[model samples]
Target: MVGLLVLAAFLTLADRWAVLYAEHRAADALKDRLKLTAAPEVEIDGFPFLPQFVDGRLGSVKVTVPDVSADRITLASVSATARDITLDGDGPTSVHGARVPELNGDVLLSFADLNRELGASQVTFTGEGRDRVLARGTLPVAGHDLRLRADVRIGRAGDQGIATTIGGMRLDVGDLATYRPGARASEGLHLTPKSVTRLARETRKVRALLGVPSVVRRMGVPDATVREALRNDDKLAALTGSRDFVHQAMRVNLLDLTLAHPEVLDRLGLDPALLDALSRLTRPVLADQLSLGFRLPEPERGELWLRDVRVEKGGIRVRLAGQGLAFGD
Candidate 1:
């Protein structure tokens, strides 16, 4: 009897050990799929993992990823769960339709970084950049060149990208005209590409103050082409009220449109053809790109699908779900 009891206890312990081991394997595989440098926090629910292993199915899976970055922007946290997962010979078989409960993405573009993009390296950041970042230097705001102290507020520009609105109302050096970003700091000031011509209708001004006309002239397409592109967009059709002649309203340029209301993109279809055209006109090598989103890499052949996008403090948390996500072979 003693021998039998001892054997049973050993089996129980081994079962628990194997469960954790399997959990780690799944987590590691997930990490690779997400392009994470470290193993994500993974948990598998169900007791006596051995039985589930033999059956080739798990009850549930939860994973926590700390950081994920495509380029300049970084997603701070990502937590997700999936039900009825299949364990495959190589690893966890592609989980179909995972649920993402919570995810956080933020980018800290220091004052220095912002300046580099603006090509105004003369400006420098002061103190910390958490709540507010102060840009101290001279910038050509509005019409006049002024030595100014600008308060930069960072927030979600739209469904994607970050927006820095400079307007805490402080001109330490010049007259009332000294701090001249525009006549009205109160107006909504957004940054987006010129090609995204729809954005100018809403914002105080597009960031095309410099050579926008030249760029627009370079890619002058007939109004007919723009109209054709809009017609192809079915999503934009469903969400908005009435679709009118929106081509003449659009000037030819190599910039993404940062609409006053970014929520519109959510309604746009997922075809990416129209957006690709708008986002592609941009010549990153020629000039500073005023993009409006995290600009994540294009998905590779059904790897994952972005479901929802929410703007939060620090960065935008985009929800993504995958059906059978596979890793490097």
Candidate 2:
């Protein structure tokens, strides 16, 4: 009986040791895959018996990352959990209640801020199924305050291959310096449709003069509308109106505008004699239509804020002084 008891005790010790070994290995592998410089420490306790290598349960694994940096930005207190882990070769790993405490940098700018400042922001990435990324915070520009939030998605489909979508995004500009000093910074102004229409008309005329049929075609209007707009000055004028109607129309047909037209190119201001030579060189490029929206508080010079101001491939919308919002025709 004494010998048997001793053997049982030895076996129990061996089982606990094995579980600890496996848990450590898995944690190490994960840290490497994430390119984490600060390796995670794991501890395991409580095993009734020597677990089978195939279905062992990890009592607990805690991962702590102190500081992770990319360029100028540094993320502190980043952690996650794998609450319950099973050593099954076929089942997918599940993670729950994951979060990062804070991300700070000299300047952490998002897509919206970059777009507003520079007119465009281009991002390219590769990943697997329905991945979502989010960022929120404030960015200061030349004494003006700006708040930004953005959500983006990357999706994959069997037939479509890889696709990306900008789920939702918003940029709030507060305390913008109005044209007039002593003016309330929050009083926001709305961009007029007339401005949008005028720009659209100018674009079409330039496209026609350049003799670029493909350029006009890409604007997505029915060939009939393009033909009619080209032939009748009044129709084109009416369609452009004083709003963003033209901007929206062209956004839908961006892909088709690549074909070139000499007449349209000439109208863009190149000499007629040079039209033929430049025809091959003329390329279709996207244009950004300017839209402005403003809002004013009770006291006109108290505070000016710009809200619901957005520019997209299709159109622009803005609200001024809590009212008089406008969209291009």
Candidate 3:
């Protein structure tokens, strides 16, 4: 009996030591993968007396990297920390007090002092048969400050896409104007290129449905061709006095009227033929460019500002310094 008791004790010690060693190795591997300068400090306080398993407590770890640079901006520090770790079973783990710092100017446009006031970032993950992640953070840009909070669930079926929704967002346009003067700070900004293109299409649709004569003229379709078509086509001529006829004429001119003689259309609108040529027009440009400028208030500040941004033909350009500035968006 005495020998059996001694053997059990040795096995318990061995299991405890192995668990601690595994934890240390995992932490060290994470540090190397992240290219951090310092290894995380880990501690395990309590051991399961019955099962000989180690329970981690009062654990704190930090990793830091210095001198990160990208796109002409240099960042002085990137640091992350994990605290108060608790592991239950071999498959499930819980951690609290996780913090990660933003990458300052290296990844952002302009450096702002307000970033320090935003506080530390955090993320949490819980896994059962699948994994779920929740994250919250803040970031600063040249013209605005962003706050984000989101939750993501993984391992879902079908092409339904990950479910995401903005919890809260606040933009400080007033602060942005300080960097670029005479910019319209109050103009609500849309960051997504797809939405902007959709808006342009919707606008054209509404104009056509309303029979807006000026808009039809601007679309480079000769009003003369439309007027002549209405005169010759008996079915169309009968409906000329009706509002629906006006809408139909505009729609047809926009969609099908390709004028062979552009001069006829130009003379009708009192404009030159070159202006009515739609050969290279009407193509929506997609903009994938990053903009770094301040939103300015009225009564110009003698500083250059971005105005009237337009995306067309898979290209994005902004009006700045009294001229259109082209940039890859």
Query: Which candidate number maximizes lDDT?
Result: 1
Pairs that collide in candidate 3 are 177-295, 284-313, 285-312, 285-313, 285-314, 286-314, 287-329, 288-329, 289-329
- The lDDT, on a scale of 0 to 1, for candidate 2 is 0.36
Q: Compose the digit string of candidate 2's lDDT tens values, residues 170-196.
A: 334332111111113211221123333
lDDT of 1 by residue, 1-329 (tens): 99999999999999988878866876777776766898888888888777776766777777777665635434556666656765445333433323222323223333333445443525554533443455566544333343545565545444433454554433322321111222232211222233234433332222222123342343353444434434544432331213322232232221232333233332321123433333332223211222223543444433344555444333334565555443234
Give the alpha-carbon lDDT of every model: 0.44, 0.36, 0.32
- Which regions of candidate 1 fall more than 4 Å away from where they truly are? 1-8, 29-35, 90-292, 295-303, 312-315, 327-329
Query: By the lDDT metric, which is better: model 2 or model 3?
Result: 2
Regions more than 4 Å wrong, model 3? 36-329
What would the per-residue lDDT of candidate 3 be over residues 1-329, giving only the tens digit for each residue?
Answer: 99999998997788677657755865575557545565544443444422423343324433344533322223334333333433334432423222221111111111221122212222112222223323334334422244433333332122211122222122222221111111133212211333223323343333332244543464344676455534454533333434444333332232122244333233222123222232222211000011111232221212233323332221212232211211111
- Model 2, stretches more than 4 Å misplaced? 1-150, 153-196, 200-255, 259-329
Worst 10 residues of 2 by lDDT: 285-294
Alpha-carbon lDDT of model 1: 0.44
My TM-score estimates for the predictions, one after another, are: 0.42, 0.27, 0.22
